[model samples]
Target: MEFLQLKYFQTAARYEHITKAAEELRIAQPSLSKTIARLEEDLGVQLFDRQGRNIQLNACGRAFLEHVNRAFMELDNGIKKVKDLAGMKKVSISIAMTLPKILPKLLSPFLNQYPHVHFRQIMEPPSILKRKLEDGEIDLCISPVPFGSPAIEWKPLFTDDIYLIVPTDHYLAGRKSIHISEIKNESFILMNTGFSIRDLVDKLFNEAGFTPEIIMEVNDPETIIGMIRRGKGVTFISKRDWQYVSHLIPEKIRINDPNWHQMIGLSWSTKKDLSIEAYHFKQYVIEFFEKT
Candidate 1:
């Protein structure tokens, strides 16, 4: 019914979980629930089907979501245009990425050059990041895998090698490299389902004709490495991770397949025209990768 109510509805609908949406919106779960209920009542239709603690958007909700998304996007663009005209703080760029640690390296120099520029970083799985990018929730994204969306454009940054890592005390620690089939029965720790690396690892296992014996699904790479160090299991990591973790001396088992690597890159929506500052920042990232 109101502008803020639409925002609340959009957040709740995006996640399809009231509590999770509330947490993201920085509001109480009851408050979010009440807001959604008021919105549904105002529209005189059931937007979401309530099932215990979970919720799913129905057909009506889905249709309304598209309109709401576009409306907000236009409003944001107008506001950004006004800010640019006013020359207030060059621009505010919201970027989503799978790796939070890389933000400093990517933004530090650029921010130094344009002191008026501001940045908002969102660290999320590639799947969610893709959705946010499409919805115009973020200006651009850096991802390890392609989103496969026609509305989005992706540019290859670099090829990052994937490695199979094991605890130093594990039996396979002595091996320089190994096939996925060799570790079929070994316990494993992996990034949770939505992460691009997890998807690739799962596909690799499927191609090898075996399922990894997963023992833990976590969100943090550092924690996964810690678990592997304690002999909890093993996982596939990238060269970037290996750099941070080399001191641990975990055995890096290269996958036998030559193509067992991910193409890390930048992605942005083509639907919306970029502001001048955003365009320049995007080019900076492109050139930065080109030089590397």
Candidate 2:
């Protein structure tokens, strides 16, 4: 029988008296009896034994009631789970990130406040991250906005100046300040081409009228720091990223003259619709970094 019929049967079976069931359900006694009869016919089973004006459930009716009760209980549990998820008692967040330092500083605070929210993180370049946002692979991106796609929207989170990172005992490490042009002759550790910070470095070198002595290329800021650690080559990174290299921070950092600041932002797809949870999380990130 259908849910409605099962429901009517459940009520009638609970009372075990058609007259009382009809009164509780606001229906006529004959109508309730007819519905129950129709239900019994559909299931090909006799549900009750009638004795004058009273009723008692048959053995088959007792067994069916047990299963119906279980089914309704499961349905109720499933609905509760959906409600809890909507209320954020159970939540998930997906982010595309480019740098390690900024992510921990931003993510730690959120996780502390919401330990229940499941976190999913992916490290990707700006181009791939942008594509992920469009395809709904990532809910948000803490990355640079790529050129030529106005469909991406960015909320300026922070702008950090780039600093020259030299080996601890290197000559430039002792400098009070240096010019970008002076570093032209030194070997360099560059980020991969699609990264936005690389574009900034290239522009600075172009303006200084020299090519960097390209030594190595790596995807992440940490790898670039690793390269610098081995004296593979010097590199540039935002002040935010440089802080994470605490052991090397002592003498390796020197701000170049005419300090250039690249803006880091929280980016999401402008063309795609944002869910309430994603929208709230994005807003939280903006306000969180805005304080710093």
Candidate 3:
């Protein structure tokens, strides 16, 4: 029933280990256990299923945890609002993105103008970014793919054409444009499955009625480019990213299909009220894209 009890329960549910949660909470294990027990007694439901030292959140616990999260979020929002009104807190913006390489260009100028503002940038896969936005964990998300949730609003920032990259000495490197089907037999160095680019490229391959021979799967763009430069395999890259790697002088051939481009967008949760700083940054992002 107490705020502290709910906090303890939320932490315990997160880790599913009483000792670990107690350690994080900086409280004694026995005291934390007693607090959770009192909370369960007050609620008249068993929150966690226990097996010796192991603990699992039951269905009731999961349901209650959702409300507990919202309660904490509301409390945090209220505090932030009060501090903003009094001009007592520094401006802070938290953003999650799948494309972290684009941050320097966007953030540098914005920070130059508002030097006092603090930014927390996180790099996550598109799926995890969507969850983070919905959970009120991030103020905004910039991604190549839309979250497609009713509670989230997505605004297209820009679209970049995808190109097939290969070593300069490769036979196909002489081509200006090529259909995806023509390269089905070529070895591919691709991003891992969870990445947005990987999903987009996979869909393109699926639609083209061919599965590419992927010889390597990597998480870093630099590594993919390096492999392609070494004639290890071919891969895809966006036109926006081409500028960064063009100096390496790899062959960048355009995909013949018109739909091969990727749309990058900005997204925010409609269910959560944006902080003043977040609102300004959102508008700044929109304007930044417009001017570009």
Score every model by TM-score. Answer: 0.67, 0.67, 0.69
List the candidate numbers ranked by lDDT, top first: 3, 1, 2
Q: Which one wins by TM-score: 2 or 3?
A: 3
Candidate with more favorable, higher lDDT: 1 or 3? 3
In candidate 3, which residue ranges exceed 4 Å CA deviation? 1-88
Where model 1 places Cα greater than 4 Å from the true spot, the runs are 1-87
Residue pairs that clash (backbone atoms under 3 angstroms), model 3:
none
Summarize candidate 2's per-residue lDDT along 130-240 as a digit string, tens digits: 778777777888765643467777777777788887887677877866877677799998988877788788887887788888878877677777767777778877777
Order the candidates by TM-score, highest first.
3, 1, 2
Give each model's whole-structure lDDT: 0.85, 0.77, 0.87
lDDT of 3 by residue, 1-292 (tens): 8999999999999999988998999999989999999999999999999986579999999999999999999999888776764557677789987666678998999877666678999777778888888988889988787878988899999998899888989989779998777888999999999888899999988888888899999878889888877889888888878877788856889888768988989999998888876887899999988888
Which should have the higher lDDT, number 1 or number 2?
A: 1
Instruction: Report clashes for each candidate as comma-separated counts.
Output: 0, 0, 0
